[model samples]
Target: MSTPLRLSTVILPVRRWHEGGRRSWERAEDLGFHAAYSYDHLSWRSFRDTTWFGAIPTLTAAATVTERLRLGTLVTSPNFRHPVTLAKELITLDDISGGRLTLGIGAGGSGFDATALGREAWTPRERADRFAEFVPLLDRLLTEDAVTHRGTHYSADEARNIPGCVQRPRLPFAVAATGPRGMRLAAEYGQAWVTTGDPRLSEAGTPRQSRDAIRDQIERLGKACADLGRDPDTLDKVLLTGFTPDKNDPLRSVDAFVDFAGRHAELGITEIVVHEPVPGTVFAADESVYERIATEALPRLG
Candidate 1:
């Protein structure tokens, strides 16, 4: 039997009242959201000048505020963090959240995060190599008592973890991967795999185009899992839906939202993460859109 469809919302921690962000997480939990996530960027695109909070601390606060809502980053990269330090932080967070933390990791992307740290920009291949090493090392750091690894991008010297994660073996890893190399990492190490679809096919196209890209990616992931002799059913599939209500939004109507979710659910998406509206927008000020989703969209998804 397949897992039921789950819903998640991305809450970008950029509100004037940081406490308001906590309230947003609480609201999501109350609204029956499966997970509440924020982006793991030092500064996000276009909102680079805005008041942004670190993903770890924001998630920590969300954990403290909400009893049951799972908290995580939409996708965390190793652009600025070392495995040794990251393992400790994640383990502590998992403990605090009572083992309801999901680590969504991706290959480091080039842009503000790279330059902000005064690090040289690396090629795509180099980034993948780094991630290939990073995930396994971090996995060991979390599951093992002591780990010593020396790699090209990072090194851990007799790193010791005291009181490892509350989740036995380690917390769940929800790895984001849209490429073959990254998919292999996801199959090897991830408890779940997430995809936002191919930008080339969907960025300038219609909602149908976006769904098509996601379908292709999902098929590719299934093949990747099979190639590794891994059961695809073991990995939960998450689709990051890029729909934020605005004028001419494709998923504007309640019916549209339900249909859109159903299409993805049919494609084997266990979880769909819709991007939260920007603060001060009509959609953000009033959460009728989300409320309708809870009522009309969620039940039909299963």
Candidate 2:
């Protein structure tokens, strides 16, 4: 099978700058990115160096401004909103994008994401277990008729989606996962699996480890599928990572990108959602990042 082309996006993570939101998204599409993504964070844990983009509104702005680029959340917490309401919002965005929408979800295992929203941080295992039940509930609501039942921590009665999603019934739903349960949930119920690297973050000489991690995740996902009697080869697995564009030389920079691309691709990464930070915020957040991405990077890589 052919590997899908890789591309990136600038994050507008829970801060407010509508102009920046519009510009970055427009620029991403004009510069040939595949999508624009945002994160869900009600408030920053530390105010030391902070930025927050009210995710939904910022993404609505992105959807309005850009014509072709798909928009998505890195991941949204399932506990924070009723599945019915969240499904409505997603379907609304689907209409806005004319079907170019990707939905990513998980229990969101971090305190930074959870505690800030007045929710408790789930133990990794609990998040995994919760995911096992969570994925089925969403699947039934989005695809079947009259989903009604209860699970360990959630319940719904005939909560079928209204207006129905305009995207194909099997829309590109994804799950954010880094370990076993998340991986398997993605395999069974997702159009794609999306996750950033480990919480420790990336460093020099560690691409190989990241590669190993993904391979293991994919293998686990495959096993999870097999146990369920589901075919494993058909799933689209993706990684959410930052793409670093270097200015000094195209060869080295593009090589770095390909290595970045290949490391994940080798382990069944069907797509890459580049989390290239916006200028003036964090790493690679400068004109140089955009310049290298535009002038030096795309030409060599694509």
By TM-score, who's the top model here? 1
- Cα RMSD for predicted model 1: 2.4
Expressed as tens digits, the lDDT of each residue in 240-270 for candidate 1 is 7663112225246667777777777888889
Alpha carbon lDDT of residue 274, candidate 1?
A: 72
Report per-prediction Cα RMSD to one decimal.
2.4, 3.7
lDDT of each: 0.82, 0.65
In order of appearance, the predictions have TM-scores of: 0.93, 0.83
Pick out the ten consecutive residues of candidate 1 with the lowest summed lDDT.
Answer: 242-251
The CA-based lDDT of model 1 is what?
0.82
lDDT of 1 at 180: 93
Model 1 Cα shift for residue 279 (angstroms): 3.9
